[model samples]
Target: MSTDTEALARSATKFAVPESLWNDDVAADLSPPELLLYRSNLLGSDLTVTNFGGGNTSAKLEGVDPLTGETVDVLWVKGSGGDIGSMKIEGFATLYQSRLLELEKHYSGPDDDDKMVGYLPHCTYNLNTRAASIDTPLHSLLPFAHIDHVHPDAIIALAASSEGEAATQEIWNGKIGWLPWKRPGFTLGVMIRDYVKQNPDVQGVMLAGHGIICWADTAKDCYEHTIQLIADAASYLNEKLGDAPAFGGEIVAPNPERRAIAAALMPKLRALMTGDRPKLAHYSDDAETLEFVGSADFERLARLGTSCPDHFLRTKIAPLTLDPERLNDQAYLQSSLEDYRAGYAGYYQRCAGPNDPAMRDANPVVVLVPGVGRITFAANKATARIAGEFYGNAINVMRGAEAIGAYVALDEQEAFNIEYWALEEAKLQRMPKPKPLVGKIAVVTGGAGGIGAATAARLMREGACVMLLDRDEAALDAAAAGFQSEFGKDVIRTAICDVTDEAAVAAAFKSCAVEFGGCDIFVANAGIASSAPFEETTSAMWKKNFDVLAEGYFLTARSAFTLMKQQGEGSMVFIGSKNGVAAANGAAAYASAKAAANHLARCLALEGAAHGIRVNTVNPDAVIKGSRIWDGDWRKERASAHGIDTGKELEEHYRLRSMLKRDVLPADVAEAVYFFASDMSAKSTGNMLNVDAGNAQAFTR
Candidate 1:
């Protein structure tokens, strides 16, 4: 019969790899230079090739240094903090290949990582600047101009199985070498160099429970070969397992209220994780997640282990799963998570050495929600999204392995060593210290405009995840996008919520729970303004004004109260007005509503104090810019009332009239709101803080 190589030689295969994209003829087509970074980008862009920070690539080239005016043989390898898909020239740290190769003699064992980490930087072409990757020596020792390494889902499926070596040999035969699972460092690099030297005919090496490495003379050939290698494994799985198990029957449309259920559980989960102290941003909702979570063996399978051991840096050894049907059962979810944390502690105790770093918090980075998919928690928005992307890709890898064989991962002791390794832990030192409000979640009602939007942006700057709620869809989308662009994607979310409606207010808070584990600071800032003398003010006019300003604040505050009480502590802020304090004629309805809202805030503060909650109001006047409350007619009347023309004069008038001689910007109001939300004003509450540029008339008693 045909050999494995002969079968792969045939064009007919289920797994497909992209055609090589290298373009050598520059004059024929004008484009960015197709060099190492270009090729790296090609590999990095496809999640099929690697997950976040999962792969490394290198190119050896003869180059002239503009700085030194000398000919140099440089190995440009991917540096930390650079994603392959978006790799740039700077992303590729150029190291003297000859200098790197000499390190093979220096490495005594994996324990040498700490010393190697210090040593590798010294040998870099630019010693004062860029540091080379730990795998630099392995890349330099290989006898190839271009090298590609990846943790592709399909490839990992085969790499992380009991029959990985046998299955791989069946497919590639003598064309590939196999390496046992050796922890990544100097020793593993030496083993790879020796193996490749012995079997020069092999195109690649499959490292069991690790990943795959492919090397060649050209970038295109190396990249294509790596893709082809992964594809071969995928094709093998397809032939044996007939692809992943399909979901049974039409998945009846998911419970439309799963999000609501998740909301109720967020505080419960947070209390279980942090004891009702800090808030964390959470993201749950991806279609493919349910298939994995709902599988017959999920409860047992998820606990078995991770398909990729290195993922322990983020996801720990395994994920904690909960019954999807119990999404709303707060008591059950909380108890389950408590058990998960206890189990993790026990595992740490079993594997931890005397020198290991202190155990990390028992809280999980990824929570598997059966019907809902996954809920990823991070200190901030960007990290949560990146982690979600990584774990989301993991589902596919494990599914692929399961389709072929029982998935295998590193043992507890091994994973613990990698996770707590001083070298690995040192890699995280480069990240800056977190801001004061890091891990706190803030929800702002009417956040699509004015003071609300300003507060959202400010909270993000201080390292809090924000959820913006508004009645206007367009404004909500635009505002949410702006904050997301500035802060980072998935950090800020938007929900259309009309605060005057009790049900809408309830659902809006629930969305906040799903977006983030729960709320730390809830801002009731929805408001509107109108002007009319009491003689002309109809009952309808008073009702409309009260419905939004007074009633809306009550509804929003009431909703936040319930959730905060569940979590045991939270902050509530009301955006009031100077109009409420200094009563103005011809705007009696607006003034009365504002006055009533301020009173409502004080009452909540009184009640909130008993529950460990703090309530405050930021009362600002003429913070008119970006305010939805100020319509054209209202602005015109305000200017006419003050005998000023144009919007600029109106601003200047308010500025000069204030004791501080400056108009109150929306940001000024936000600052006061932030003070109450943060511990800065930890002891002060049940009162209003004036942000009207020092308006003595509006000062509280």
Candidate 2:
């Protein structure tokens, strides 16, 4: 900011500073190096400024070598594999400028460029090693004390165009160096050095098909200059393009409708993307996505390449664009995705060196459907969401380039080198192995609380995309929120479903299918408990228990069977009751209903065996503490009917009946459910697992 408060207020720069930060005396007290970290965070927090760890920042500081005991001017540059947006003091890897320049001689030009990235850790300011940004040399060669290099969308629009040179001079009112596209290495670093030598008065340099670099002695000056450069480019583009059209032609359906479409298409899409195997699908149709898909040049612009190289690694170079008319054509959709996969393999082959690892999976990260917007696929919800965010900003960047001039992207070879770079590939190898159920989809009925909620959480912990269904709208919502809070968003989908209603059951399954493709594991857990002697049972009371406990299981299992039959594989677990086996007195309605449900599971198992679907049952006894079925006076009712005095005594009666004599918590039932839901019981079906602390009565032969 200028020293004059009046001029600062009236500055009219398109890149305006937050008014609250303008006169902060505290910021003034921060050292120049500390301000570099501060300003990098501020610039990075905005996706338009830097997309997904795509930028670097630096500051020059004097440091005494601990071992050599000599005062050396060190260039503290943002390290490799760190995000500038959330970087801290340690994020800047300190390098001795004198030692760094020594490696510039062995360059032998671009062929040996890989050495530039490999040699950085050995050129540190002290004994501790850190992988510095390959661009560290450029920062040390520049005379400025503070420097920032970012892939801002506005500037990249100009930098990536054929007209980058003329536009840079026209917009900034100062000549900017323009180097032809060169992969980050010794050659590019040297080119930057020679540009400074020639253009002694220039404030910055722009790399064609790459991005821009700016510097000044102060953090405020450098950051302000970076912002102004971006602002000016944006102004030039806006003036040339006039007003941009708001993204349109989207359906903007209600949640259920959108979810239904998602469920219907997701299965076909997942099958196409991964063949017979399973994967996670994340759907969206936000305004930016709507506009991008609806645009006339959507296909041409999308094929141009990632908005930047970093985006390519996360989003792939180009998304798979599918026509909504082909939604029902499973063969065609799968064929289209397969063709995209093959094309990516061909691209990798054209640029691969012998040292490069086999081309990574052929699946495209982003898939676009007109009117439906976009869907990102990943092993888990978290990575899919990350790619979704990157691709979202990418549409804006590509559009800006169209408005500015022609949007040019890195060539296939340029992007291939970065994608296959050993350093880059190593990052993925370092990630921990995924959970066993990482890509599996699970649906848990009655998921609001009790055993259902515990099973939902456990499935998510093992990395499944879980859908929660219940009759209580408020409880279902609260349960969904808790899962999302614990697992991060998009991992859980909730539906207000009364399992007794076939239409609602079908819709809930349809929504789950759309949200996460289709179900791999189904838990028919929704039930109601109403007990009375067979002779005393009223028609109303008998009908209610049977309707919820038996009919609900039948409806859910049918949906699960249909989905599995179509896909040729699935798992189902019916939550049964011990009363069904022991036939407790005065529990005729509850026991009989549960008995029918258990038998229903066995019948379904016989038919599903042909389609590779496994079905089992979990008989849980006297889960009295957390059972909502015993919420009101039902606990007392059950106790009195059984000749027991209190709820505590009633629970103890069932506990003592078990061989292990332990309290059977809801989580205990969830564990038995997980065994069948996962591959652990791959060959087991038509079986009943007693989760009542070893109740012999409920045990199956």
Candidate 3:
């Protein structure tokens, strides 16, 4: 061989070793300039595997935010969408480690972005653009000091092949882990989290049909390993297929008409995922305009996955194809839908075995048809993007596979196995975001008092942007203040609303949607209580308590329910009293009102189920904080009237009667309220959870 040819052969052989096996120490001490060089070389190989803005990179450092009291902090996560190969300090967002961890613990409602809160606690981003990369949670999920997420085409090409996973595994040699596709964002991050927990030593993860993730002790190590990882995969591919083939087929052109088609389907698709119309990002007018105005294959092109995995979690496995041939008639569309449903059922039955689990629903994430474009589905804008990514990638892989050896996806049975796998499905149900209610708008009736305040605070913590509705504006403001002090002003809202008035209730519901997008969770927590003999409860006396507790709960819950039903999915909680089940002597009016409210909750649950909404009731025993009936003098007078010691009367009224023998505090009721309002109880509907410290059994006059 010529001397230069001999040198080239040696260099190529040196690059053949698996990169992940390298010790951290080798790249650990590299200077910044050296680190940049390593990053460039690594990315050159991986970049072909990633699409525009498909990945992010970060390096960890211990520091303090000088402007924020010099608190010890985990500063600077790279900005969303910035290329890691040439990332700069400015690309990173500064996050307070303590705050991010704290936010993760905050409970969120089913309707909110728990992931965003989790990300927020760890990263700070540009307030100017108001967008963060969807992969931020992956950064939070990693324990390593550095993190990198990329859609390496070679890695994905290897992973997307019919035997892609097996092929990658041969190269990965158990050092890396694999996550089945899900649309990106919280769901994908969660999938990564579970995998990492099981395989703490995994240096990288392959997102099938999506991308790759690589991390280590430092930036240079992470970047270099990524290079090595991709090179190894490429080598494997080269050995199997010889030289890679050139792009042979006609690329699909973009058509502007595709946007109108996508826009039409988005509304229907969003409701199916979330049971509500979640706030979504605008569709890409640029891409749609280009696609719509350009190509005949635009529909086929839009049917694929995004450049990443979690996009499937958000968008589903594929888009529903809008075939022009089929679209010509309603019957044709109906027939196609029937086939889809049957296919889904068949797929489900084939997958579910004696040991297999069940999911909330078995539905196709996407549908494909010839001629027309695809419609991506999601619960929100973020989810839609994720769904789109998954579909986009799937189309790419399927087409490519056809050229090699006919595109074939995991069979119905195998797909079913994955779709219903316990761990995978559980990602949808894991340690929920504390603020599941964050992006969602909500209203809490009786939000001025203890139960109301506690429930509202709990919802805020979980992520609902709230409108505190009550007649007592000052008290509502005070209650909201306590929550705002802890959570921040953006979370709590207050409005002077008397639940007794239909017009006022209607207005409040309207206000909630207008202020914070739309209402998704409602807490009918406001009420009044008083005791009077059934016969002596005059019309005026009867009307007053009943108006607020019974009629009020009904009115607010009804309006919220109507709005929620229209939105497609929602959750509502009615705060009932233990008196509803075990009546108190001389408390006929209060008990009757609570009983009615409980009934209403059951009815709401049954009706809302069709819309994918959930409704439940929380019944707590008497709480003493700021109760109108429990003023000191009144308590003493009541005890004397009842011929019982005040302490005995109070004790006998609550704690000692229950199995747990503890007072049911406002916070305790709030816990149950939060449970019913969030996804924790996605399958628990129309049920009542008692927060009486086991007081349901003990009752007396």
Candidate 4:
């Protein structure tokens, strides 16, 4: 592999799909459905074989019908909207083979093919609720016992080439048949079934502008054959490719400062793209992405769009490419966005029928910036990341097709038809409704602490992506790892940031912008505590308290406010203490510093109001359990102030001191923080909410 970007583009290496990973020992004890799942995972694991959620696999098995005590053939296929790689047995839809064959009798012809889908439910086997994919007939109508339908980039390249049919015959020596382009449906499935009957020796058939389908008499053979077919296609393409440069050779080198540039550009792009709803962003500047975007043929190829239905469904018809030389030109960027929207709307108007689903948001999902990289936006982090992966697959397809012959995209009419298909529309409608904070991004200072971690978790549960910032690197890693396991890696990121350092605070916010587009909620919860009489307070104690609570709040808020102003709307929550308002008897240094922090929120709220940014404070008192602050000297100091033991006695003292006589936990403060961070407090700003168990002196004036 070459290290130079241009040299890497010019170097053509052999593309070898991994060999079949099946083991006889593993398959010996497995049931028919379990074997099918094992086979599906092996194929779907490699992107060269199939992109995420882009393929279907099935096995025909004998089972006793639940309603009737008779043996019947059941078609267990990958269900709708399921990813073959990670899916379990439950992800497969079970339908009676005889009933699926009977569905063909009611099918009038090609025009009435869609009506066939409506009858699929009547064929349910074992009363399985999993919805059958539209590709069900492609498996059931075939004569083979097992089938694999996958959109491998290698095979799709030949399928999408202008000379695809002739190349398919030359490469496979007539063993793999070819068919012209047709939208996937019952009609296409019937065509495939008839073609295989005519060519009895064929191993598989490549569908033009789509993918390949191969089958065998048993599960293992079918899985191996699928891998072999892809490997062969890749082998042929590599020989034909020679040392030819991909994508017409790189036009420019990858920029070293691209990440910084992307960070600067994302917030603006996010603001532009979020007309309907907010979108989280994923950025990729990998070797492949940088090579394609910097190539001379980038614009021409990107404009032609992705050929596979699975590709376009996730990435949209075409990506919006920005001029590398004018990337910093704001007017040019805005104009380009407007032009792309206009083109999309025009395409919709030209191809849509009366019954088609109303046009979706016209914003582009994938954005290609030359010399920088690819940035994809979606309703959440996972979808955004997957969109980028799918586009990368499309790039590979384009490279292979162009190497063999001229690359071709799906026709605009056909693309639009599939894009607005009624079944696809129904699938969209079936998706769960968006959560309250679906596309929102949050940053929490002191994120390794109890209250900070609790606040981050609460925000994530409501659908927000979060960046955890703490000065303690080990603690930050542990906290981030826990959240990543629970919420997924894409939604959580960590930064070793001391909020008191102005430069680190700014850089952390910049990283948040680059990682998740921008911040919408900023939780300034980082703090320190000190307890001393007014006369006994040391200079270092007062300054240290002021530095973290007062100065740290000021720095993080300033950075967050800048980002929110760019985003046009945001929320900021400051975690203060009840002592800030009530004034503690022995904790003069901590109490006075908190008072300054509370006043800072009011000032920021006034400043941010006109820009649609809301600032509020959550004042918590005596939250000892699970609190890192209370784990150290602060606990002993507060205990001494109250003349109580430094253990359970201190907790009981605080509980009884409150009017309600209840213990305050980190979760309680977190809820109050969430209220201010969410739209529930949308109209309320410049206000302080006390989370203490009701102290008379702590009552707001």
Candidate 5:
């Protein structure tokens, strides 16, 4: 007999969900879709049951499209960033049955969870007109029309228990198929699809410690199955002497004008990073969430995530705690923001990896009011709805678990591992297809200021998760603050790394993963200049210059290639100098090191392509507006040595060179790096692009 049967035989001796229990109405007065949404939202909020961005849910309504007149069927699935509890009609997207089935046939070799959703029909509809949930495919995979996937405390309490799988098998028997937790997304869909196809008679799938999937031909059937299954699990728990402790927590007062609070906070947050305003969602104008946020255990609870993994993707790892004590203090608010950001920095330090995405700015996604209510944050309305639902459910679970024995969620390191795993990090690499650049992690060494800063900024604007690795702590802080001041903190991140050290470089890359989620575009822009004749260019001068330019680039490229290879895709760009191509007098070490850097990039390009990684170099000529190479005494001396006035030399150089006649600028060079870092040059690997404004040809002059 199947393990499920043997377990079922054992469970047969325990209390089961009586057939009559199905007749009792589920509380909360939710419609079929709305009920599923509410339950999912609740589950999404439960840190004891779900992880941030981990789980998904769906409901299917068969209907013929009037536009087609033919039997055109569609399955409305939950799109990514959507949590079921507060999910609205706009949070769902309709995929034609034919398309979902067609997508099933062409199994791309195991892809990331979020990108796997991209393979679904193009989002032709807006969230307002048509929202799409990421779990739509998992729902579509079920034989039944209505399906729900949730991570519940009582349920996972059973799943993660030592006898969990066996217990579930016994209770569920032939009715449920247990699936080991694979990372959710396309691979997950493939796993479920294969299982369902193999076990055609199963009514549900239980994932160990992950959650449970239930389905039925109708919404009611699906709901009944879920409720009964959960009840059965709860019964089993009670039998084992597990009693859900009484809910205990004092409620805080609500903020009367909560909506105004959310609105005023948006611009302040947007000022911290580059992106659209995050959407906001809330429940109970009275603010139960606020009370929950102010609970004595709030700190530990706030940092903790949902019970299962999938919840993290929806609610993030944790919600922002709005302290009641600092309610009216602006300084306190500022300090709160600072504290949150610093905490994120610490989290990055603890959890980041070599290829992880960088941390976006730290902004509150969900605000737990002391007495008022909970508030959800998002870049758009759709995401807010998702946040609100997932967060609300998560808070509810925490509150419930607190009544028993404090919600014991995953540790920071565990959360970090999942958040920065290669597959999940791959989502950071996703860009619009048929585009300029893709699958490249460019690290602009010295990226905290000047051209390095500009290069990092330009790369992100061009769709790369730019990792700014610089030794200048002051520049790093200023750049991070400046970027957060403008972009809202989620897009860009800075690392204080001395690139010459291999260990430091490796650690910095790991931090990049924790900060942004992954690294694909690398710039290697860190370097220093010296203007001395061959005799004056001492051993110290040679070593220092080579350390930054040659050794630094080598370490960075090696790290980038390792991550890219594991991910099966990536790109790297080296910042080479015009002096490297044609020597400049009195700058022997700088020139030679740059030449070595260029060759290093070319060799990487040749080898990286085999692993689906592209490598390239950008040769820039005297484009130094804020560079150490061009400022103060260095500029005048170089100009005098080259036999022309500084201003006149730059002008003559630009004019005497080629047709464009424009002076090379950091932005211009950055644009070249951006092109190679993105899909614009997908097939152009092992290449070198010049951003020298014709000055490359002038080297011969």
Candidate 6:
């Protein structure tokens, strides 16, 4: 190695991208398409290499034509909106190489390049339904059999540096070439093809203000080259980096109580962001994030905006930075958010063409606070988390670029064009309509129980992110795991919380705020059943019932109310027992406790009405199936009271005793809870719904 290379190797330790993970054994038996997917996954596994859905990979391979039964060259590229890390083979769009090449005849110039996307459908090789990405032409027009186009933070740092071309020439000498920025489309693809033709000896080219495109004859060679290039850039940046602190040193020290501050601020921030529609949030206060937010150049660098298209697409043109000292000042925070929205509106108005899509919600997706860190809001938890990740990548790019030279951002007009492109608008339109509760956050007490789990499922089905709270850790994990598997891990979180403990209750709700921004629905479904004749009832039994049924309800509801009030709207659903109204013969303690809980809901509803908080109840009778309360002593006691057998006979006796002769289930109660939880009962509050198989005695008077 040269003296400079040896010195770089000695000095560079920070920000190293992991070596290539490709294994010969893993790739040996895979087909060409599968190998392409494997290559994409290996490169995309690390955020330092590429972000979620931010890069594309393509393979030119021989495929049998269905009609002709002859082998033909085909191009398989990452489909539109597909994440390379997690995408399957089916996520790749297939097109005929010859047809893609023929598209050159239709392209008039850069002005008509966007029209080229319309012609891609005619090039589909096997009638593949996966939509081809705009980057398709960039890959197809290249001569290599395998290509990887990725936005690695390390390489992007060089691309985004003001001295990027000089640095590229310095680092690689003539092995790598450089091209000026051009939005990814037919025109840019032609530019890349021409550049490669002129510099056939060069392995790749860094696209200024964007990323890098590298290719090789084999997928393994391409993967290795990509990793080596990124590693070299990271080392070069690290070596060039002096002893100075990043972002011009820290302007504010990270507060140890930053999470507490974030929890308090999130609901208010969410309230402001929800003017157009509800939004879920993700908070990050990691060391790296804190460093960036607390840095002196935070505002300046953020104002310059992210250089990569993927970064700004998720994070927006820029983030809104708040004064850390004014975080607790509600009016100040509100004014700051309003000012941000106004700026965003002005940005849209200035850049929008006559044919551009109408301006979207002006609320900022990312918020930066000096001491606290970064918070991102989006339509759901995953998107919010991904946005935070993308911004994190942008931060790294900025750090590296500043180390090498002055960081630069894409031009304002170019950024606007990409942000509001007609094709991008069409992609947005193609997304499935969001569910009714798309941005709502919910918390279910006794979340491991049948009723709680069912209610959580119901709310989640409508697009609400749920936090499951239960005292039983094992059951909570099992329940959360099931939901995570079905609904994805992003939408579900678990907390070990006993509802009766005020501290635990408060902590659980705080956790909900930190995990999902704020709670919009609180399902008070935690309960325990007790039975005793009036003469046999003890003070201990009565106190136990009240402590759980009535007091537990109070603590959780109070916490929920506090959070919801900050957000300006919420719904609370209390799961009461049918006996609370009908008065069971041998269950005085359970019955009276539940009655108190029911009455409490009415009082809260009356008080919360002016604040847009809706409180309601769903009373379920003899929910024998899938009910934890029905599994033990309560079942035996109720059966003995009716002189029936302990198992199926008791269930049948209650079913027959009901006016409708139907057995109630947890799912039945959940449906009632759902109605109250959603906007379906928006106009009806301070009310109760009976899921009791029509027992007139339990009906609300």
Best by the lDDT measure:
4
How much does each candidate deviate from the true structure in C-alpha RMSD?
Answer: 5.5, 6.3, 18.1, 1.6, 18.6, 3.8
Candidate 5 stretches with Cα past 4 Å from truth are 1-441, 646-659, 696-701
Q: Write the per-residue lDDT of candidate 1 for residues 49-167, one digit (tens) a residue.
A: 77777788998888666688888887888886567887767777778877787776777776776677676775677552656776666687787888887887778778887777888
User: In model 4, which residue pairs have backbone atoms overlapping below 3 Å?
Assistant: none
Residue 418 of model 3: what lDDT?
48
Instruction: Mark the regions of model 1 whose C-alpha exceeds 4 Å error after superposition.
Output: 1-34, 65-68, 243-257, 275-281, 285-287, 324-331, 643-646
Model 6's alpha-carbon lDDT is 0.90
Off by over 4 Å in 3: 1-277, 280-438, 626-641, 644-653, 696-701
* Worst ten in a row by lDDT for model 5: 8-17
Q: In order, what lDDT does every prediction score?
A: 0.76, 0.78, 0.60, 0.91, 0.62, 0.90
Per-residue lDDT tens digits of candidate 4, residues 366-473? 999988999999999999999999998888888889887899999999999999999998888888998899999999999999999999999999999999999999
Q: Report residue 341 deviation for candidate 5 (angstroms).
A: 34
> Per model, how many backbone clashes are there?
0, 4, 62, 0, 103, 0
Cα deviation of 92, candidate 3, in Å: 9.7
What TM-score number comes out for model 6? 0.97
For model 4, what is the error of residue 427's alpha carbon versus the real structure, in angstroms, after optimal superposition?
A: 1.4
Q: Could you tell me how far off, in angstroms, the CA of residue 279 lies in candidate 1 after the best superposition?
A: 4.9
Against the hidden reference, what TM-scores do the models get?
A: 0.91, 0.87, 0.43, 0.98, 0.45, 0.97
Model 6, runs deviating above 4 Å: 1-13
Per-residue lDDT of candidate 6, residues 1-701 (tens digit): 33422332233225765698889999999988889999999988888888899889999999999999999999999999999999999999999999999999998899977799999999999899999999999999998999999998889999999888888998899788999999999999999999999988999989998899999999899999999999888878877875557777766777778898888889889988736568999999876677788777888998988889999999998999999898878899889988998999899988988999999878899999987989999999999999999998888889889887899998888999999999999889988988989999999999999999999999999999999999999999999989999999999999999999999999999999989999999999889988879899999999999999999999999999999988888999999988888878999999999999999999999989989999999999889898888888988888888888998898888899889999888888888988998888999889988998989888788
In candidate 2, stretches whose alpha carbon ends up further than 4 angstroms from where it belongs are 1-37, 61-76, 86-98, 124-131, 138-141, 244-260, 275-277, 501-503, 645-647
Model 3, position 29, has a per-residue lDDT of: 83
Q: Report how far off residue 637 is in candidate 6 (Å).
A: 2.0
Better of 3 and 4 by lDDT: 4
Error of 2 at 632 (Å): 3.3
